[model samples]
Target: MLKTQFPLASIFFTFSLAAFSSPANARSIAIDEATRLPLVKRAQVWAQPTWIDNTFNFDDLFNPATAPLGSPDEQVLTKGTIDCTYLYEAPNGPVGANPKFKCKTTAQPSLKLKVKYGTENGEVRGEVLGTRLLWALGFFADRNFFLKTTNCFGCSENPVNQKQTDPNSATTPVSFSPSSIERKLAGSEVLKLVPQADGTTKVSQGWGFEELQMVDAPEQLRDREALKLLAVFINHLDNRKANQRLVCLDGSSPQGCTGQTVMMIHDVGSTFGG
Candidate 1:
């Protein structure tokens, strides 16, 4: 009987010690505010004083300078005709892709062309206006223009012999189907070429950088809350990571880009209240 009682007491003591020895809080995870990011919808937005177009005017991001926007870098090609196909896609991309293609033109050598679908969603207008607005405000945005969608004849990598009746004249060989039928890329289609770049651009999706420029990091790249506010102002609801990209000035990949880089906002499809 004494031996059994001693064993029972030992078990109880072991359990008690184990219970008291447990950690006060969950040691599995350590929440660090410094490294964590807030939810997109819950992100904080603050107004800051900014100088636009070399003018010292008291303005916030929501209301940027109305001055005609110009390029901060010499590489930004503001005008061009998109006559080339995308390098990733043949003649044209899958119908699901952003109506992009390739062209052979002397307008500007972006080599790739992106076209807008139609006016129902105003994607072309949205992309054009949104990019222009951002570029005007000094953000790295692509150069887009209102181009003629009728130029897509024989632009498809996989050509077809079938014919479809035109909506207006009831004719064959229509190039404005899946594309904006009645408008230019803006109305029928919006056109833009990939801006030519000499430096290796860091292609990033989320909020981080490879090699941050010391002087401009704090103002232009880091603390990009102003950009968020601007996105909100433009009604860009599709602020997903897929819609954003980054590039390095030295032509290095993100991991190899231990140099200066630029941030770019693309596919502003859901803009102007869409």
Candidate 2:
């Protein structure tokens, strides 16, 4: 009787241990913030700032030398923030089995303005005009914001050649692009680009604009939708496509060859008429 009872007790103890050590339980515990210090640290590291120099500005679009600097923490733009990293997810497949590709996103806060030119009104106007044009055209876009700074230590000076400059160039006391530099400066947000899944990489533009050569069949319906939106934007203001894209997915393959079609329009610098 003692032997039989001992065996049953041992079995119960093993089962309890296994149940407590299951993967589901471990996953739930991992998701708890208190228990996931390592994960939080990793996320912070991944989000560290990678600066781009010499981005373009449309300060002339607003009244020059009149815009007043707003507080740094003020939220000038309002829109849903997207997890830009996911734009690079390859088609469904076993992890580590597919070829890796380079991916990038320009959706982060890219613009910083000098202290003298910073004003709430100017920031709002720039954001509204750019966002309205893209939204009217039915393309995915990012919201804009303003950053005010008193010193010119690490701020972008030029609007056009920002990506080509040395990241550690000497600091200047004025605003200057590759073309010219000025003593006082104001900054504006610029559009960003990110790499998408393989085989789904095609971009489109407004009427009279050249279509980007892509690998997959173009979705006519989505193209029409984009065109309609473009028409509305152009009618309001002469908006041109700085960047355009189309994406497709297919169910038969895991390589993004056949799936729902999607379009993106980016970078309508400034409005023409209104």
Candidate 3:
């Protein structure tokens, strides 16, 4: 009789523990000021910022920088022809498996392209979807454009298979058959090369997730948690330090981020899939 009662008590205690630790129960806790994020509407997050040019900006358009800093220019390229000069292609990988290239475009000098060809399950579609969802939810996301066709000047015959001999040299032309790409995505992830007074170009290095702990008064704890939860919902498995970026909108230099810095996930390619 004593042994049976002990076992029953143990089972009841385990069940109670599990119930208390569940997410549903945890959300019941009272919200505090320190943890609550400021009032944010789902629609307001989709408003387009004024500054679209990611390159050089000297005019008064840079003033009155808004909160939730978006990329300089955030829009889709569906109308005109996208002519790009192939700069370089990154080494292939498994986690964020996709053919990506650093190309210089007429509109955006520093443009990153994700190409989808053959039978590849590339991240172009997933990335575009993920960024749009995040942007709609009031988060800074890369300005992505899906182009059905693009003219690649000085491109390799088989770009997807082209291996990089030297990743440092930007001018080294890997010419093939001048690739005529079909189904590609253009996004903004490169640092802005702002010209300084000393006749030199300055670029700010991006920040990692660990920097969130150093977040000042502008960032709330709930905001950070919301991002993490969103990542889970989007099935963003490759949520690493290199994929996330923290940029500044001080409008000074590429690295001049003294005013208001915005945290965004540039690489959402490995998302929206179970």
Candidate 4:
């Protein structure tokens, strides 16, 4: 009886494995030219499986109120006025000012901004226009959301969803965690690898651009393929500085840093119809 049962169980397990492992059932959604949609639209279509499970929502993170509103004299990062409250904590103490004036609740490892607006066609619209041009050029970029006054307050609202790669490798729609010191350092290293024309280089250890000499170390050549792709993307976007970078595990170890090379893009805020 035991022998017979053992064989039966083994056969059943084999069959179950075959059924579950079928390629048809294991396939992922295809990404191709024809199927390619704007990242925002793709997020909406695939939200349930791709974003919602990863803790993303349309109304939560992208709210205009969550973005800082600019002052009349200030320069806007994009078109329209972003809510100033989105940038900082309210001025008052516990009682605070108007509830509407208070900052929106946010999770840690997030991006924060200050209150300020840019000139109409100058700052705000220019950023947006530049981003749009970059997207058309086929570079990886960030999405910008337009906010209304009502949306700026805590009233029930949903802003347009834009889809961009998450900087966080661990999360969906991955974005870089500005809070992570290690990640920041990794971004700096990538900048050092890419070369520039002229005597000066385009990237540096700091946040913005500065004129620096280019290095031609042999190890830098190992990253040529990845760096070339990244440079093309940045140049197409008219990137003048190291804003954001993409990072991946080194090839040799796959699990550990080989010190060989990985790719990363930084400060994507200015990307995709900013």
Best by lDDT: 3
Question: How good is model 3 by TM-score?
Answer: 0.50
Write down the RMSD of candidate 3 (Cα, Å).
17.8
Model 1 residue 217 CA deviation (Å) reads: 7.1
Model 4, 203-245: lDDT tens per residue? 2321222211122333333223323343444342534444433
Better of 2 and 3 by TM-score: 3
lDDT by residue for model 1 over 1-274, one digit each (tens)?
0011123244335323422321100011111222112221122112121333455332322122232233332122222222222123333222433443333222434323444544353665556566655554445555555443434433442223212222342222224322311111110011112223775433223332222222222433333544555666667777664455443334233123333334445557667753
Off by over 4 Å in 2: 1-128, 136-139, 146-152, 156-242, 247-259
TM-score of each: 0.46, 0.29, 0.50, 0.27
Span of ten consecutive residues with least summed lDDT in model 3: 22-31
**Each model's C-alpha lDDT?**
0.36, 0.27, 0.42, 0.26
lDDT of candidate 2 at residue 166, scale 0 to 100:
28
In candidate 1, stretches whose alpha carbon ends up further than 4 angstroms from where it belongs are 1-102, 106-110, 156-223, 251-255
- Model 3 per-residue lDDT tens digits across residues 1-274: 0011123244335323422331100001112222211211111111232333466233322122221223443232443236556665444333334555545554665544434422344464565556655653446676444444555555564555664333333354443221212222222222334467999765433335555544434335345555666677678777665576544333223323223345667677778561
**Ranked candidates, highest TM-score first:** 3, 1, 2, 4
Superior candidate under lDDT, 1 versus 2: 1
